[model samples]
Target: MIKVGVVGGTGYTGVELLRLLALHPGVQLEAVTSRGEAGTPVADLFPNLRGHVDLDFSEPDPERLAACELVFFATPNGIAMKMTESLLNAGVKVIDLAADFRLKDPALWEAWYGMPHACPGLLEEAVYGLPEVNRKSIADARLVANPGCYPTAVQLGFMPLLEYEGIDLSCLIADCKSGVSGAGRKAAVGTLLAETSESFKAYGVPGHRHLPEIRQGLETVSGQQVGLTFVPHLTPMIRGIHATLYLQLDDPDLDLQSLFEARYRDEPFVDVLPAGSHPETRSVKGANHCRLAVHRAPASNVVVVLSVIDNLVKGAAGQALQNMNIMFGLDEAAGLRGIALLP
Candidate 1:
């Protein structure tokens, strides 16, 4: 069994890691870290996980985490970089769910994240962990950078088209909507129920932090520079993400339906719905599945792709666990085989 450790265990993503790992047959959770909640019982804090994980939260310590075979960093953007190098030296595989190591360029990363990278040298060593696209790299990597919520949905939706020749890459637009939980468990005025509920508005119109990450992912697939106009909206729901992608087809002969079918034929979690079908976020809630639907608007050269995932599952914690399974040579769907929770 792979002894697992999680740093920052009190937030949405942290608890999510615990929830999923608790049922993972190959994982034995060793430690969970929380500065303020140190010495608190994990079950007492999260009643939902009462009988699942029976461990106490402790303060973050690199030495304590080094003992585990694998460690997941579910902390904020800058926290993972502080300890990844030491953990790697200790021969512990690392999967980070933060934005610290996602981007390849430190300048662009720093410019958007508002601080210089703490460890730029590690950038080239960290593999982008999107199982469907970068599985081979993740399997061989010691350090995996799990993607952001928005980037995961957007990249998966457009990857099939972007990699194929004769697909117009110049005019691509991703209009995404995410739940308030995507903002994190931190208290913020913008996420307050009074402010978010009954109101749907877009934040980060053209320059959200997830933009560069999404662009980086698509570019890697296309083998060239890929640019996009991404807009993220805040919905009042608690946990889910819906991304509608618009792309232009350069080749008139390209069949949008067959293209997606042939591309994701072997993928486990990516489900391509029938043509003209629309997917709802709730359809993939609480599961590590991404439901997709493709459409070609006749006479307009426009093809639309719809993608949906639970923000905390496929978008964050679940994806991190997926990377851990790859690094350990376990089945990619080990602890994530459940269906989405629907109302």
Candidate 2:
């Protein structure tokens, strides 16, 4: 079993990572760090992992973390970059589930995230951890920058279009909605139940931090400059992301359904639904799956694609585990085969 440690274990994504790694057959759980909650039983805070995980929230001791073969940083942005270089030098692989190393340009990252990057040189070395696009690179990467939740949903919905011809790449629009949990477990009046529940409103239309990340990924995939309007909404729900992508196409005979299916045919986590089907976020809740469906507007040149994923699963923690499995040459789906939770 590979030894692993988690840097932050108090937030939503942190607990989700702990939940998966605890029961993983190939993982030997090590230290879980929380400066605020140090010495607290892991199960006491999560409850779901009461019987599975036996560790406690300890201070982030670099020496203990170095003993593990791999470490995951579930801390907020600006936390991982401060310590990743030391862990890498200690011969430990690091996967950051935050925005610390996701953007290649340190300037852009600083502008978006509101902080100057501590380790600008490592930006080029950190591989963007989207298994579908960087499977080969992730296997050999010592540092990985996990994709953001909205970017994961939007990018997956738009990927197949980039592969085919005759689709307008200039006017892409992603109308994505995410649950309140996407706001993180931190206490905030904006995400309180009284404010979010029984309401629906778009928050980051003009500029969201994920906008540049999504554009960068799409441009990398298409090998050309991409013009995109990515608007993210805060939904009342607590666990899913639904991305409705719009595109313009002149090819009347193009088989979008077949194209999506063919693109994701070999992918284990992307489920391309049948033609005319609309994927639901609940269908992928608690599973590391992106369920997608494609369609053409009747008598119009507009093409629409719907993508759904559990915000905390495929969107964050579950995808992090998927990357770790690949990095270790283990089964790609190891410890990630759980069925989606349903009502």
Candidate 3:
């Protein structure tokens, strides 16, 4: 079993990690830390995990964390960068489920995150943990940066079009909507039930932080500079991300359904639906799967791709577990094969 430690174990992603890890057969959760909730029984704060996880929430102790085989940082952005170096020195693999190591450019990271990077030297060394593109690299790297929810959904939706010919890579758009849980388990006025429910609105239209990460992933996959416009919205639901991608299709002969199927055929977590199928977010709820579908607008050169994933699962904690499995050479689907939670 892989002995693991998790930092920031009270937020949405943090608890979600505990939820998945508690049931993961190969994972032995050594520690789960929460500075404020330290000394509280983890199940006390999260009743859903009452019987499954019996450990108490402990303070963030680097020495104790260093003893684990792998550590997952589900904390806010800056928190992971502060402790990752020390843990690495102790021969523990690190997986950060935040934006700390996602961007390659330090200056860009500072520009978006509004803070100096703690370990700029580790930027190049950190592999982006999107298994579809960086599987081999993640399995070999000591540091893995898990992709954000928006980037995971957008990049996966646009991936097939990027590789195939006749798609206009010059202009792409990802209009995505996410549930309130994507905001974390915080008390934000905008995410309150009174404000979010029965309402739908876009928040980041000019430029969001995930924009750079999404463009970077696409540019890396296609080997060309990509032009993309990303807009994120908040919906009334509790958990999910729905990304509707628009691509300028120049090749009528290109079989998009086949392209998506072929690309994700060997991937256990990505599901490519049948032609004309529209994938719903609930279909992937509480599951570590990205469901995708392709379509062609009548008489228009526009091709649309719909991608759905549970933001907390495939987008955050679930993807972190996927990376851990790859890093430890375990079955990629181990502890991740549970079906989506449906109403």
TM-scores for every predicted model: 0.98, 0.99, 0.99
Residue runs of model 3 more than 4 Å from their true location after superposition: none
Error of 1 at 264 (Å): 0.8
- Tens digit of per-residue lDDT, candidate 1, span 92-118: 999999999999999998899999998
Candidate 1 vs. truth: CA RMSD?
Answer: 0.9
Each prediction's total of clashing residue pairs, residues at least 3 apart in sequence or on different chains, is: 0, 0, 0
| Residue 165 lDDT in candidate 2 | 72
lDDT of 3 by residue, 128-157 (tens): 999999999999999999999999999999
- Pitting candidate 1 against candidate 2, the one with the higher TM-score is 2
lDDT accuracy of residue 327 in candidate 2: 96
Which of 1 and 2 is ahead in lDDT? 2
> Model 2, range 3-46, lDDT digits (tens) per residue?
99999999999999988888799999989999999999999999
The TM-score, computed over Cα atoms with residue i paired to residue i, of candidate 1 is 0.98
- What residue pairs are clashing in model 3? none
Clashing pairs in 2: none
